[model samples]
Target: MARVAGKVALITGGASGLGLATAKLMAAEGARIVITDIQKNKGPGAAKEIGGDTLFLEHDVTSEERWQQVVVETEKKFGKLNIVVNSAGIGTEGTIEDTSLADFRKMMAINVEGTFLGCKYGIEAMKKHSEPSSIVNISSVAGLVSGFQMCAYSASKGAVRLLSKSVALHCARAGYNIRCNSVHPAFISTPMVEAPLAAASDPEKARKRLLRMVPIGKIGEPNDIGYMILYLASEESKFVTGAEMVVDGGCTAM
Candidate 1:
């Protein structure tokens, strides 16, 4: 049977990378999806490609009003929402001395504040349904460990990790039957990783250096993380909440 069959999932950043991959995977497993991204052009094509009860709405996660609208539209169209994927985020690198306050705030606004809003609205929407629901926030191994130059990024992601845990505890105590968890992925070959890798003098050499961090000898595929998210979105994870599932090929283990 389809794991998420008949479930309604709203995924931000669904135009590409993990969000797009998750949308495709969940749709194939019979979930209704709302693919939201700032990329107006790519979002529609993604929705069309899914070829089912899928929607693509241009979303700005930084805006609380937009989050409100997205939730309202989702409930109106799908009647109820069962899954929320806070996959919209950005990557930046700079030491504490080199990082500007503006850059740090921008990173927090989207990565932390955006995810905060996503959780608030997602919880509100998911609680309306009796069936078990899930909210999966896409964090990073940076949240668990650290990068010398990723001070602000790590802080933002760390915020996401803890926020997910708090959401889970709240829902469990409130008897909402909702599950909230965080997925931490490291060095996944996605558009988010493309620019950083390309910035190296030799992209291939940079790729190899990154691979050394992953004990599994892989940089990870979007589908790998997608599959993990699927399990969390499904009934299989009904007993799972307040957990941090790492899909980083053991990067933090080292």
Candidate 2:
């Protein structure tokens, strides 16, 4: 049988990058997928590429009302909610001193608050299902370690990491059959990273510099993280909750 057969998955930021890859992987494993992202133009295309089992919704993760709408629409369409992958996030480049309050708040709104809302609404939605469910929040290596020029981004991700654990423990204590976890990846090759790299004075040099941070000597592909997401979204990770899984090519090992 397919790994996630009969599961219904909702993935935020599913229009591109890791979320897009995860959506494809989940759908292939026989799960019905509901992908939401603010990139409305690309969303329909991604849904079409994923074929019949997938649906796309225009979503902005920072909005609570929008999250509620996504939850209601997903349940209405799929009849049950089994998995939620909160892969919607953004990264900013700045040190604490250089970062502005506006910039920091933007990061928090999208990355931290976005994740918290996903977990809040996801747990509520999944409870309506007859079976247990899982929630996967996409964090980053920044959440686990400190680095130069990454204050706001790191702070936001750190909040996501701990929030995931908090929610996981809450679910466990409440005797709810829902599991929550976070995935922390480093330098996965995606448009999100590419844009910044291309803007550098020495783009190739910048890419190489970023690569050197990973002990594995290579950047990760979207699918690399996607596959990890699939495992957590599946029954295979039933015992795994309140844990942080790193997909950073051993970057944090050093």
Candidate 3:
């Protein structure tokens, strides 16, 4: 049987990158997928490409009202909510001095605030049903260890790392049957990584720099994290909650 058979998954940032990758994988595993993104143009096409029990919604994750609406829509369309993946985030490159207060706040708004709202509303939606559910927040390896140029991004993701654990504990103690965890990936071959590389004066050199950080000697694929998400969203990870699942190709091992 499909791993997530009959499950309903709502993935943010699903228009592209790791979110799109996870949406595809879950759909293939028999999940009814709700793909949400701030990019209005790409989201519908992605849902169509997934080509199953899938939906696309225009979402701005930073809005509390929007988060509530998305959760309601997911439950209405799919009849229940079993999985919530907060895959939408932004990465800004700057040192502590280079990152302005506005930039730091913006990063926190989308990355931390967006994820907090997802967990808040996801818990509400999942509690409406009796099934065991999972919430996967896409964090970065920067969350575990700081990079000099990633001050704001690191701060945002570090918040997500602990926020997920808090949410997991809250739900578990309340007997909501909802599990919350975070997935940390390093240098995945997604648009997020590609954007920085594309902007470099020497794109190849920048690429090599990234490769040097990975002990595995290659950039990670989207499916690398996607499969870990699959396991978490499925019944297989029933015992797992409040955990930080790192899919970094040993980037943090060093």
Candidate 4:
């Protein structure tokens, strides 16, 4: 039951968290995987862990030059590019007034610009192949909702939401057979969420506070989001494009 068999996937931020979870799942499902991250130390190990036909490269998603190199490298190794998951991003907590201009710019650069480059270069690589292709951009529940302390993060993700739709529409109009979509997750148990909790005065209490927001009595796991990403990356979601898939545990419902 290889859902994504015969596909080649390049995942950003694959060193840990949701990206790592998705890499492992897709690899197990028989897709060749290319995992990239700024974490040069962990990226190679993660690729080795996924084992079969997996490659890891040190990457900075915000750099357009690096994006070109990665996509080229992916195709050079795998012969074709089929799926791309732009999961590399950062989260910063601050109010509009508290967040500095530099901080906001950095958020936009990584979360917004990085995804843009991934889509741009990923499409270039996939166009060479005549098969259907997919691009999954990892947004956040914050993209769909607002938080007092998530001004910069929310702005970046909100940009991702629309950027995905625009890419989808353009590709469809051009008959590229490439689908693009965004996935929004809430309170996933990843380093992105845990680091904030760990820094709190009481980590357990902070975790509970986040759980309360979910409306499901618990936070989410990385695989919770990874599964949705897999569906989008696989041919099962062939007709899906320009859609926002929310994996939140009823949080956005509230």
Candidate lDDT values, in order: 0.93, 0.93, 0.93, 0.94
C-alpha-based local distance difference test score of model 1: 0.93
State the weakest 10-residue window (summed lDDT) of model 3: 44-53
lDDT of 1 by residue, 1-254 (tens): 99999899999999999999999999999999998998998998989987886899999999999999999999999999999999999998999999999999999999999999999999898887788899999999998999799999999999999999999999999999899999999988898898879988999999988888899998889999999999999999989999999998888888
Put down candidate 3 lDDT per residue, 35-149, tens digits, no spaces.
9999999988999998876899999999999988998888889899999999999987999998999999999999999999999989888998899899999998988999789
Report the lDDT tens digits of candidate 2 across residue range 1-254: 99999999999999999999999999899999999999999999999987776889999999999999999999889888889999998887899899999999999999999888999999998777558799999999999998889999999999999999999999999888899999999988899888999999999999999888989999889999999999998999999999999999999999
Q: Which stretches of candidate 3 lie over 4 Å from their true place?
A: none
Give stretches of model 1 more than 4 Å off: none
Model 3 residue 178 CA deviation (Å) reads 0.6
Cα miss at 185, model 3 (Å)? 0.3
lDDT, residue 22, model 1: 95
What's the true lDDT of residue 147 in model 3? Answer: 79
* lDDT value, residue 165 of candidate 4: 99
lDDT of 3 at 116: 95
Each candidate structure's TM-score, on Cα atoms with residue i matched to residue i, is: 0.98, 0.98, 0.98, 0.98
For TM-score, candidate 2 versus 4, the one ahead is 4
